[model samples]
Target chain A: MAEGTTDVPIAGYSAPRPRAHGSALHRMARRRSTTALLMCVPLFALLAGFVVYPFFYSIYLSTLNRDMTRFIGLFNYQYLLSSNTFHLVIFQSCLFAITAVFLKALIGFILAHVMHNITGPDQKLWRGVLLLPWVIPPALSTLGWWWMIEGSYSAVNWLLQQVGIHPIAFLSSTAWARFWIIMVNVWFGTPFFMIMYLATLKSVPDQLYEAAAIDGATGWQKIRFISFPMLKNIISITTLFSLIVTFANFDIVQILTAGAPANTTHVFATYAFQVGINSGNIPMGSAVSLFMFPILAVFAIFILRGVTRRTREAI
Target chain B: MSSATLAAGAAAPRRGRRPSIARERRWALWTSYIALAIFAVGFLIPPYFELVTSLKTSQEIGAGTDPWFTQHLFFGNYTSIIHNPQFQIFFLNSVKLTIVVVCVTMVISVLAAYALARMRFFGSQMFATGVFLTYLVPESLLFIPLFKELANLHLINNTWALAFVWPTLSVPFCTWILIGYFGSIPKELDEAAMIDGASHLQMLWKIFIPVAMPGIIAATIFAFTVCWGDFLYPLAFLFTSKQMVLTAGIVSTLIHGDVLDWGHIMAANILASAPPILIYAFLMDYYIAGLTAGATKG
Candidate 1:
């Protein structure tokens, strides 16, 4: 794309007086670069101040002691490494992120295919309804989940009782809390995956599917051969994106469990807040949060590779 | 029949095969409707139930009476929440912060997106990728350091703190979406403007901005929703009742320790989510377009 744009100006300039055009082109290039730099000033400044600077600062903070008065290199890491709560948080965070991402991706893929199979106004209406979970704020939506699952006014339990079953404690127990946390994460995130996959599904040209049908391909076979391969890039990118966000998730877990029932439900973000802010162990919290960095870095690299590869294929 | 005869018979009269195919399609369609209905009901029930619960009396809610419906209508939950001074502060704070952050994000994003999409400069590709990387850098990772950074700047507990911090979340994705939007415009339009000696700024202001209004609107909606819904940042930075935004404020204040107010809490949730929900209702297409474009295109 950049080559095509640059070619246009050069082709136009080639017809003009050669010597004059050369200097003019150089001047134009200089002017264009200046404009680009000037245009990017605000963004660079904002990223620098908020994103880049804070990122490095977090690394710095993680090295410091609890109060951050003195640098205690690797002490926070050493302490967190051996701590059982931090270990549980690591286990829980991985379990929550992976399970939620997998469930969301699977549910979203099925929902998108369902939406695709339906037609017209029905599809539009269902799409809108399905997106409600994603549209609402996580903090707010999780409150509704909390209310439904809370022991005092347990709506789900009430229904279970109606069915002549025992009312289970949803959030009061460790396993139940973790179960609800992942459930809520899947609920909130599936719509995003659905919308993304739906868009990708739309872009899969009808000709491919028609050709498949002509060859006597089954619905499952069409999806396997045509849909999955076509959607591989998008699926990976969205899953990785969700994985990173879920791995560092704070809102759903915090609002629902707040790492309750013995902190079995704590992920990196919630645990970081608990240790850093609530406990006033800033360095430890920073360390806890930074634990997400290496995993996310790996995911980020994979997503970037997928994005660039897809773009290259498109080109 | 023999296989050749069966094939010949199948090919001879397409009309004869129509009813069975139609029947199969009808069955498939009915099955899809059932599946979709079940999925939609499951998805919508929680929020719908919250809405219902919010409209019920506290006594009814506490009694766990009819989790699906209420006998008596009650406006007290909504009224009490709206009338509460603290809740009002949370609402106003959210509004103020969302507006400021959205404006800042759109400006920064538009300028950056324009540069990256239209201008050929050194390191532009790297910078564009950097923006995406920054977007992926979750606030959970940065909040601890940001807390210290804001403290050093004395911006903690100040609502304006978010105005500075939220762009880290909003700008990268907004810029990415806008880049896709801007890139989609035919190059000739901008190239023609350039040949006519239109400056880059004028071209951006007059041509790109006008043609890319949909994308800009999409980005604006995205930025607005993100700013409105963000939890981790405000949760970390703003501690005071006066400082808190709607999400953190309502959660912190309403659901005190062990004593839970189901009606008021649900009402607060509905109220807090109202802005984004209303926006999504009106601009659903733009919201989804921006999101998909950002995810798929980038």
Candidate 2:
């Protein structure tokens, strides 16, 4: 503590009395804290205006009638609960988020291992290629994907046509719509997982692997004993992060599928936009988007715990 | 002692496998290369197609031909999109909004992060945790409410609304990042600066900012990209074609009703997405560290 400054006065400098010193120090500390609080005003205002205020406002908005004239309590929620489209939204959101996140993690794990295995400069070359997909904005990249799968200009279907197979419409069928949505998401997200895993994988000590090698453990055995254990923290953390983002994904679904093929592919975001913005049913849209809240809150709790623990350890 | 147990547990079954480990390792390396090649092709195929489609004339794209090969390398799509004054506005708006938002986000985040990390104020711990939780709130979840709020303010169809709301998306994460970065500097440096009569702002500007340059750059890049790439807010709030930024503008203008312009759209998409991609390619380490550090600390 930088306390008792007045008690240790410098040469030829008169020290203040003990009581005066205490009061001065208290005033200084108070002033410092006041300045600190003032410094955070912009952040506090933004959070309150954008996040906190809107959070409660959405809760309020979700309860109103579609036109916002009449106060209807839980009507929108009840409507969504009863509606088949909302049911499909829930089912498809869960399926897409879980399946895509799982594939990303699995592929990321494998690629990270391979990247770690490469001893030469080729690692950089492969990494540059792999991470390219994530570098492009999701909206722009989804447009590229949409171009490839659109009618008549579909490169994939062209190749399939050559194989004596029928050229299928990729995004018009319900099953195919869900499949492609999850595919683009997994494609966009896997590089993030790979980069995260590869970073943590690099931190695992070489001696541990070499020691395991000398102990008669095979490549798979070394991974099971060493790499997996070391990577457990990051795997959970990155999976949780990716899970939240994937659950709330919009661009791919909006640009590529637009919740199409009979409203069979609606995630919360797209459905919210469909009802609220496109259809002009703001209350119902608010209700749709608010369905994403409970899961987000659940993830937030775990993310806070992990991130704070890491933050504390870093400090 | 632990190694002894581990070695004892594995030595019996692994004794004969040791001699073949070298051969097995070679095979694994070859398999890994093959796997990487597959992944590389899979990942590159989309962007490759984007490039291929952008280079060809409309007839080639309309012919339902193979998109893998670009026979005539034409630059008309790029030239047309660039020459169009409407696209020029969207591009300029994106650059302007992104620059302004990045500056604002950095100032707000760096100040708040420094304050929270350094000076103990009322509910600072709770405030710090609140920052992290705020970041987890996806923009998708709040777009509806924010839309209504912006409308009530009569800011709909106005680009100014985005200027006000865009930093909300970036500041929380950037603050969290700067807090993590600022937490690393030794306390004695600050203590010494304080003893020498440096104000909080001076210390932040003169000492901490210079020391934490990498973190600042990383956070700036993050803010810039988020603002540049934000599709939902602009899509909802900006109804006018002139009001939309690059991401939304490209869709609104390039796709007129049932007929979509593939060449110009891809070119615009390429142009719209180039900044962040180029930034990532150049600053991969800091970008990755800043991005993943939110969950998995660097």
Candidate 3:
């Protein structure tokens, strides 16, 4: 890698060397640099045109009025700050993300441990079955969830009624709606956590566990001392990554609740869509969504730092 | 070592002394099994119910029939949904968008990843990090401005519009995954090719790609699934029935505000979910490997 970078300027400047040195080196260097640039052109173009450009454009959009004809300074942010619905959205967004991430991490950790203990073809079969929810599209799976928890004909409610319990209104009520929303999020997301933790679990040397066993370490002790420490970096990274995703999640909430039961369940992304697109206030929607940036940026910086530190340590 | 000997000693008295240690291990294993079984059942109930409900007659579904099983199987739901003209358009739009987006993403990511992994340009490190950062930028953050951008381009409600926008999401992660894969390739192979007068493009096309086939396939699968499963972009940008992808299309068309045909809705969802689930079934290892590679390597 170092050689590739160093060779370029040397080849480009080789023509200035003694006359005996040929133009071939310079041409080669020039060709290499051009090739590298050419290779990256499409990627940078896409990133700039779509990702980077829209990002800045969103900030600009947020500064505009409802119709977006005129700039209104920080009015959008100021308005959202004062608005009660936006306040609910902010609170719900944080609550939803934190609760869902915590549950997903916990459930996924447990599932990974179960999977780790189960030895044989059964494990592979079980893994395949367990990951179905994550493999399916969120919107589609949420559709299934919607039907299962439909207000009138909830399958779960029906099951409850079978045992002489009254049917619970899964989606019709605010609390149940919030509960089911987070439940579906956890269901859809846990497999990813499971698969990730399972992969990390596999890397923990069996010899270490055997040593722990020889020292009279129980299962929990092994996990606390050996497993947790080995998994600290991955857990932190995956949690933060999942936190960002869960915070910005739209499909589950949108499909399942659509901010139903008086809009109490709306998170940042869904509320942004409701206000921005559904209500035709694109600027406010942009503002709503833009709120995710600062929070995610903080997490992204930490994640990147963790990644680089891990890479450096590996090297 | 002492525990092993103690277990051996306990097991030596086989008449009436089943080793408590062995029993404890069995109990632990059984506990894992029971917990996994319960979770799996709960995890599978929704899709299972969807499948079962999709087979129920409208009368059966409407009459609040058994939620777990259908008395009479009705195949009409699948047929009606499959034959619906609006659904046909949505299906075609989804297929077209997914194919185009996946192709564009793979081409762009592969080239960029090769450059970042092999050729050390002046700002390669920063550019690589930029790619990962782009991956982290959620669709929620970009869709508002992107909607405006598409409107300006007169591409709103155009299925082809997704061909341009989906790459923004796919390329970054695909590039990141490919970088890991490409970086893992023995540096000497590319060096040997370079020494033998292989141009950078030749070295990439002829040497790097063939060796990184698994990574390339993984990236392709990832891109395809992400594009196919995307909801927000289609929801925000494409309004017409003719342009919406499967996810947005199914939700918009199947469920009216007050009246929903649960059978058809379930069928549409199953249909929409089929590709990714099928792809996952066949390439489970590759998918897991790619996912783990991206996560753990970072």
The model with the greatest DockQ is 1
**Per-residue CA lDDT of candidate 2, range B185-271, in tens?**
777778678767788899999988998888888899889878998888888889777777998888766776366668888888898
Ranking by DockQ: 1, 3, 2
**Model 2 agreement with the true structure over A126-229: per-residue lDDT tens digits:** 88889988888888889889888866448888888888888788888888878889899989999999998988888788889877765668788888989898
- In model 2, what lDDT does residue B248 have? 84
TM-score of 2: 0.94
Write model 1 residue lDDT over B1-298, tens digit each, in one string.
2322444656656545533333545776888888889988989988998999999887787675779888977989999989989899999998988888898998889888999998869999899999888888888988998998999999999999999998888899999988888888888887788778888789889998999998899989988888888888888888889999998888887777365778888888898898898989889998888888787565
lDDT of 3 at B17: 43
Supply candidate 2's per-residue lDDT for B245. 90
Better-scoring candidate (DockQ), 1 or 2: 1
TM-score sort, best first: 1, 3, 2
Where does candidate 1 clash, by residue pair? none
lDDT of 1 at A135: 92
Q: What digit string (tens of lDDT, one per residue) describes model 3 on residues A1-315? A: 645544554455455675535556556556766788899999999989998888899899999998889989999999999999888889889999999999999999999999998988999999999999899989889888888887755788888888988877778798889999999999999999999999999988989987776565777998899989998888998999999999999999999888987889999999989988889898999999999899999999988877777677656
* Docking class of predicted structure 1: medium
Alpha-carbon shift of residue A117 in model 3 (angstroms): 1.5
